[model samples]
Target: MRFTLSSSILLAILLAILAWPVAGCGPTPSAPQAAAIPLESFSGRVLTTGLEAPWELSFGPDDMLWVTEREGRRITRIDPATGEMTEAITIDEVLVDQQHQGLLGMAFDPLLLQGDDRNYVYVAYTYDATPDDGDEQDDPRAKVVRLTYSESAETLGEPVELISGVPAGSDHNGGRLKIGPDELLYYSLGEQGANQFNRYCAPIEAQRLPTLAEVEAEDWSAYKGKILRMELDGSIPADNPELGGVQSHIFSYGHRNPQGLVFGPDGALYAVEHGPNTDDEVNLIEAGGNYGWPHIAGYRDDQAYVYANWSAAPDCEQLTWTGLTDPAGIPKSVPVQTESAWEQDFVEPLKTLFTVHNSYDFEDETCGASYFICRPSVAPSSVDVYPHDGPIPGWGGSLLATTLKNGAVYRFKLSGDARGIRDVDKLFDTVNRYRDLAIGPDDRTFYIATDTSGLTRDTEGGATDQLANPGSILVFTFTGGRVKSASR
Candidate 1:
């Protein structure tokens, strides 16, 4: 259906005439403004530095923030109110800073310090036997273990393997873990070097691409790129979706390297995925559903691939809006054509992106994978979707996240009562760059983690060479819709 020059121009004019009246329309009466927010900044002292590739943050039962550092193989504690940091314990048995390996994720048992219910910290780390010498991939051992905390000594005691035998590879070792509203430990698992079709192994003979739920059931014997839900004791839940009369632990599947997981105020699970070069996605997850991956990049209206049976398919038409430009410098979607022009103008590169996959395989082959990796932004990673004064007011329950590449925290707010999801605004940004954010108990205070390796620094630290010191964490307090200040 190629478009003729005159026909294209006429069609564009007709569309423009129809859309001009609604150009500035918004769902809300008080539309987002163009002015910069004078954000307040607060800086907290470095709780604990000298660690390597620190990732993941959560508050402990004591109300202090608990942090995990990958390379240093240690779990540290921070007194958010006092700015004092303490190293609780280090896992000397686990390896750190290896390609796709390290002490990756941690979650505290909500009920800690009970008699028989003594709470424990669940940790996912690289368990390779490889020495500190280079070439960590050859070791290949990654597992999830629970570390019990002893109040007397202020340390993480003996480790117990909650789940084991998870295969590892140079890439695709998904390590993000979170305990959901249901009190089940939910974590993502990468395919560990399996073919792309492994992502589609769902629906049995139904032939439809597996939904997140179905993919999780893709036979743990062959599990990859799937999310699993299990009891704190590591037992499969009785209610888990069953296949062929066999109970499975998978919640959803068909995800390519999901590094971020968070639950919304309404109990919906949200995940950020690395897409194939062009598409990154933040998915609202449901039970027994599959998030279309290898088979479908972004939302495909063409519906070339069979989406998971119960997975609500993405609206592809809305995703076609890429902010590219025509030869004449008029901004348009990719492959700008005169026949079909964007009714709405492209604003800024979406300040908030949920999925950011790269083209590089980051493994055996050096070839480009073609997945678009989201770059870093100087702006704050947080965005807001709620309205301060509107029909549905008050903390509209926005979700905040960060990027490892460019260190931008992205906050997203949801409007409308519809069960489905919608994109809101790319609200305010922070002065410093960081990834992964935790909303303080106060709700208004936000904390960010910065990787020292990549930032513009006084010295040019080469990429491949591991730096003894990598990054620091920052704290910010946002009051009245702006950041107050940032702390070290």
Candidate 2:
């Protein structure tokens, strides 16, 4: 549950290396390397429908799945046994903003089965209205609120402010929350204007500069673009790493917008991050480590923000990521050029290529294709680590993740007993297509939250509905005693 700072940084570096290409090659293989294997998936009946912008899922005290609808402003409960769903509670009394403000994340009190008979679901969401300065999105209180549910897992008690005062932006409110193996609630919050650097994905304005005094004396205590860890009761833990005489509640900083947080079977906290245009990242969160966000995406370091004046040595291979730059400006995009400048300078100015085989202009006419991969129809948004104390029937151990675009939940079985799963794409299978998923105590069934983007799987249908969903929860029942054979 805890790791030293050194291990965290090392893992970050390892993630960077895995994310980018290394040497010059014609193009990387279109498929994952030989060692990588496909993962298996089983389909189940769809449980509930008519959910509006559903976000996260967790198990309640009564063996029902709890879901949050970002736009519906409702907490829903689904019976895992029957796959039937009902709106347990609706927040018609509380102010609801149809925009980014709504229920975003949900977490259950582990003690629900223990001391208190009360069923409680903690949530992070945006409140109605903003500060006069248009900075209300950055206000912490407006970002996260905790509500208690009745014993039947329906209705609500008066809302309690567990921890408030987190900064919100018009968007990029990294409000995903989860209680880690350490029994601490770890959540993410992103900074405003964090999207500008990825020129290809969204319209980006020029970067801003914080005055030197603002940079040093600024109060980072308030959450914004940080991964914060606290007790289930919402108090910052004491053992968190310290920075500058302050016990940084920030387990790690420099994240753009991390939507996924799941502890791997190995007990490591793993995160799935959406990058500007080309990069979508899966990171291992380590205590006291800086994820190098607003400063780095994937393995590429941002030279503009100098950390401690550590001038990254140019010739130093480890300093910057040159192998891959998320094809800036493209969403649901795949890499066109597999060759790195470090290997073939002749292939500079890589031109964009479309799925239809049309080519964007590139100066390098001599270039040849080596890798012809497409962007995944589903962009990974949230992840759930496998082999929990609950029932995860036929499947032995796996990592479950969800995609925003595809509305499919994927379960990845790790190979080798390492802290990381190398070349995961190789293990990808056709059935691995469900959104955020959680295993039931019955083990045979796992619940999934569907994005309901209504996009066709062929033309990248699930891309834009990252937040826009008439979302719903469903249960997947495994018929065979074991997972289906993994496909190639």
Candidate 3:
């Protein structure tokens, strides 16, 4: 919500830079584009390590790096200068981790920048339905709360719940939050955690079916499979697309676990979504628009996507997504319809990936198969518009997208008024599940949270993912050069 300058002014500066455009960046269909920042321009160092499962990061008051740890169930304040954990507020009681669900997104109230008396940090997390439940998902639900920040005490005070009962599961809890320039809160909800289950299961059981009735039974609006917009105080806006004032918080629906949401420089909303095995997408968000999932993935309703490990072929169309509820609570879609989700009008992603396997391509090989892509997908964990006056060429106006399965950070540049892709460059890659990210107030320095839990679990738990390393927060400051074929 607190941009250093007005978007209009930022756009003006961006236009001036765009005047001196670089070479060969014009669109081509088959090949990946060249890096906007020369290979030598990029360098990274660990800001800190030992984060259990760091999920989100934000530059809070006094320039402290505020981070949310999913497995630790705490919001921690890190002194970036010394890479030390200075303080933390534990919320493990309401922040259970389900590998995917846990303490998630965070945003600082913008008013704090203007004055000191009422700075509150909003945190979103998943809570257990009952104590010591055998099930890991355990009927766990999601919630967003505002914690008072006390600069004097260097602590986060008691929390006040703003939104509650958002749909949740061990996977696909969609716990990403962003406050818009309008000062309203925007949160995402995935499709009932069903996709994560059906991704592997064959001959799905009827019991796994989730109906519109069951979805509506939750306290919040048609949250699952939707993006919700609410006032900072949790009230519905008059401009919201709700009819008759019921189910008022929905900003848009029809998404399959949107992991990243950020407003572009032109004030347009963007979302990064995961696909079924292939075609992971970066979409341009529209209010009240649908992003097809379970029914359709990428641009079309493709049916057959196979899991290379088990070679299990599952059809997206044959899979079941029960009913879709309109904002007014009426069923817009017929119950239990198994058709191409594309049949019902839906928007397409701005960019798509074949898979996460080739995220770090050292060179354009003679044979593409030599450089493998991750099997199921390369899940994008977070995305942000880089608003910076920085040294990296053409990065002053770019999208910084971070990954989970592939463990890479990508910088994307758009072309023309349509915001279509001009290029996609892999900025860096590492042996970590890069979970979430945030840029500094200066915008020149960027920060990322990695999954120590995901990376090291296999090694420590006696499994065999040899890429294990301690989870860490990485700081990258860009400088320009053309050095080639190097990686850490």
Candidate 4:
């Protein structure tokens, strides 16, 4: 049946047809709008590849890039311009155990290459501990050694043990070394990953301090989860604060796993540490200060974190780990302490990467079994400060932090005094675990080192094992002028 329509009715129908939404023509319903990328213009290139689990990257006084291979147990030097590689040294004494345990953290002496006869390179690594007379086997131990670099042979030798027998385990070694403005060596040690996961029955001693007799006997059992300040000869600094009336190598205490340590231009020490499930922290480290761990996460607001002392549980070995709080199968014998319940005074973090409420949803169907990678924490690995005269505009006096889970560098703009973080912006996001980064001599180029393999969030925000650049150093050069955001 056909019917003739009036002119006015026909015009109205045409207008309605034009106003109807079309598929893929506009924003999708219930989908979030993606924000614009921040960088003006940049280009990336592979500076050097084929590294075996590169852990640290630093530019030496010779203008050559020095890297530590965690699993390879070797130190390599690379020419940044030509990408030529050279093996400086290979320590056969180093032990490599799955992912987190191996050679880690390298620092150069300030007098290196100055012909001052002090061309030293400090390295921290795990080693096999000698079993006692009756014990089956001893836990793994870590040591810090000083090696002299030969100018003529271009090799490292003459190993001098600075400190040894520190608490080390299969996980949470921390292992970050830095030379402070006072010309002292600063090393960060983790809590050995106790009271969680496989080691849930082990006690956490981050708050423990050594006795005066222990220091005299060289007992570093209380050194776990601490920042150590020492002389080049391995003696404790004279001016170090005496905590609990006992002086030792400990500079600060109560750290979980502080993997990133750097001295800012203002002479203040900064540390970046990983939290349990949330509240990754950027801290302004102070001598003798305690950054609460296991008791407080991020702030004392009692948000999403609670310190569950599984080691104190009566039947800890019998309970299954659900990796959640207040789950059904967990017994009430386990002591769970909130942030407010702790009465100790501790320093709060300068910045928390991402903090959420206790009710925040943690499950993500897209992440599948590796759902923890989809959590808010980015697993901060390393940090560096950009100078005020950096080549990139609006990036001066900023803190550049590297992440493992998110595979990105988070640029945090610092306040004038450098004590506060004004704001943060994510940059150089790729599907690779960013282990460390170093600024080039020109300040226009940035060299980022990535792990050989790891789980990282893909572009679609799902957990994936694919990496764009593995075991390689990527160079990101800033190009002036406005253009579309470029990231690999």
Candidate 5:
């Protein structure tokens, strides 16, 4: 005999199930120390191979692995269980202006996770500028577009332009997209750092923009050296920091190649922006807060800009330059560079990653005292904080930063309130340009994307290895015991 359920009895059962809490599904962890545990050993394994310059890796609904290829102009979805390619979409409109520019950043519309019937994906890329000008303007501009995905057909529809005409350059088109805790879309901007002002004979003769007013004159159209906050439809949030102008999307300004943005376990937002020569920085992002780039980098001092290098590096002629004694010898061509009289209102970075050599001009400690000498620069690509109770030992309450320069993943062990740093450790160091990393549903799983070309750059020039390594997607498993990572 079967038991029949009444309508009231069925309603009560549904409500009870809805109220039940699920593990690994809750608000962001408030305190990392509560979940901290000693992690003595760890191991990792390569999951899939033959990824062409993979830029980003993230998990969507149902733990489907989504990845973006920088040079391929495509997004591929892979089945984590069998390492099979499930879906792939090629975005042909993306323009490759230089070695670094292409289909660079992508993110899922946060609304999709709410179980909406339809969801869109957002991507940032360089678009051709001055399509009509066959003779002159060949500039590359940055744009963000939204597109709908059809799982049944496994195709991406034509893109709908969300925000376009943002300034972009070959070397410093800061392309990193992230959905923030506020449920808004946030993206970074770079100043196209290789201006080479003195050699270009100012903005008058060679550079078209004669005055700095065009850049800093309260313009939303110009997306140089800024971080923007916007709604899903690409409208500027009204609550964004007000600068007395229509350029309201500006969340923070004065940045140089902000490559990484991550929301911490404690709900804090952090940004990792690259420096020109020496001072790579990791800053605590704040509304209306300016982490000075061209003006003051890392710390409040006049010597910061002195480290900004141009084409022929090892240009130690500054040690014998004529006009350095002047307190205002920093690059003053740009109008915004002189703002607030170099005040300390700009937020200082939590830590300055040493990317340069300390000795300049044959063992000159005085130069290191004032400015960081440029041996090379650390090109940090992406960052993410470990969720509480993660399986990796001592990694639950720490920060993980991935890099392209040295092809290393560095862990920043925190000290106070998630602000101060206790020490940094190498989770795993490999000879691949690590572009992105994502934590899986369980603490025991994680993934990384790498630019696996064997070509190596040394200071100014690079040499290509005879045996080239193709790009790959790696899967890491935490066994919960101290183990040899390389052996595994």
Candidate 6:
């Protein structure tokens, strides 16, 4: 044992052991993982441009593209083949704020597509609610209206007010309207951007349920942060869920800015919502279900998120609003609650776009003052479910969610049950804010609506105002080819 071996002999012994493959320690044998479809396999082109703040994109029964212009206060139809635009209607009553107002969602009745006499289109928009007594100026409110379409004249007119006066503000006016499979109108409303930015001192009423008295009086103040189910005539559905011992138009509660609502092939309703700083969510919406908002973000995982009630501060007006935990300006008077503090039963999200630990840095100098966009939240604007027999190979049963911050489309693969997400893939990465998307009949072609102007992350991972396509529709068609595969 005292005798030492030469350096060459010792090196030879070490090499032999390193080359030996130990049982259960070597790489496990498995099928190669399918990589994300390459951008090169897709051909992209601008369909049209020079629009003003396009919001929603839907294909009508006539195979034309219908779009809502938030600033233009107009519903326009586009010929998908020729890109010729036709103004369907101009909402003169629409009150456009600095952002997130004006004409929003539009949906056609099922009978309209069946060539029946019901040529009706439902739309949501914001209008001035200023009191006659001059109580509040520039008070914005939201409503849903039914418009009759004239096939001969190619115009939409005879507007009938359905529901009105849902809480609205300069931001967080979640005005996504959809006609559910049950033949009921489902509308989403936000918390009016309370407890953040300019409205930092405003209290959030998302958890507030409407009383019987308020419902009888048609007061929709409590309708904020809720999804409403109503009949074609704008009356509450007879079979609507009774929440908090009161049966109103509210189908579900506890939502914060749900912008995307779609029905999957499985006949289940899904919603896409924005989180505070992180944890953008994709949820399977259920009747009378409560989605924890201020109490919990993504899950009951006490992670990076904390519901800091700035409005609860005694001197909240004096304290400068800083979107940070324990920032220098924020005092101890501000109340903060963890996700675990909420013990109430609620439905969890199917998936969170991104969730991070508390130790994650928020003050990245690279993003400068606009560091919020650099965070994990992608600012999801809309979502659409791909058919099970989609044209693109291996892309079936996936959700295509458009992001405003990332300027790209994220494809989330759904599990066989369609209740969970299997994996995620990013597609059509560009330097423009994607407002929404409409999948063509071919399913391989997708038309994406871009914001007129906004700040978005650039290719180099920096925030910039320069957009590649502004106020335009960009189309991406998947070409058949063998995509690259990688080991999982």
* Least accurate 10 contiguous residues by lDDT in model 5: 201-210
lDDT of 5 by residue, 1-488 (tens): 11133444334323322222111111122222222222323344566777767887888775788888878788888777677775558877677646567888888887764668547888888767676676222667888888887766866776888888777766667788888877788888776644443322112111111134543443344557778788878887879876534346678877878888888866688888786554577778888776765556556543323433223234333423222112244343322343235554677877666422223232234334322222234567888888667766666666777776544566666665887666555444444567888878886776878784533322222322221224666665666754322210
lDDT of each: 0.51, 0.50, 0.63, 0.82, 0.61, 0.82
For model 6, residues 1-488, the per-residue Cα lDDT tens digits are 01133454334323321222111110122112235675546777788887899999999988999999999999999998878899999998898866888899988999875768899999999988875654332678889999999998989999999988877888888888899888889898889889988889999888889999999999988988898889989998888998888999999888889999888886788889998877888899999999998788877887777888899999999987887444344678999888898899989988776667667776667777778778778888988999999877788898889999867787778888998777666677677899999999889899999999989886556788988788989888888777665333
Please say which candidate is ahead in TM-score: 1 or 5: 5
| Best model per TM-score | 6
Please write out the lDDT profile of model 2 over residues 1-488, one tens digit for every residue.
11112444334323322232221121223223222211223343556677776777877767778788777778777776665777867765323442335677777767765667645667887664434565433342344456666654457666777665455555666678887767788887665433232212322211122233432453333455678887766665889776434664567766667777877656677777665433456676777666554344344322111111112233232333322223442222222322121121111101100111112232222222311122322356687765645344423455666755333444454445634443332111112223467767666666777654433122222123233223656555554433223233
lDDT, model 1:
0.51
* Lowest-sum lDDT 10-residue window in model 1: 456-465
Ranking by TM-score: 6, 4, 3, 5, 2, 1
Compare candidates 5 and 6 on lDDT and give the better one.
6
- Residue ranges of candidate 3 with Cα displaced over 4 Å: 1-32, 131-137, 195-218, 243-247, 301-342, 355-373, 455-464, 482-488
Show how many residue pairs clash in every candidate, following the order shown.
43, 26, 4, 0, 3, 0
After TM-score superposition, what is the CA distance of residue 451 in candidate 2 from its true location, in Å? 2.2
Q: After superposition, how far is residue 208 of candidate 2 from its true place, in Å?
A: 12
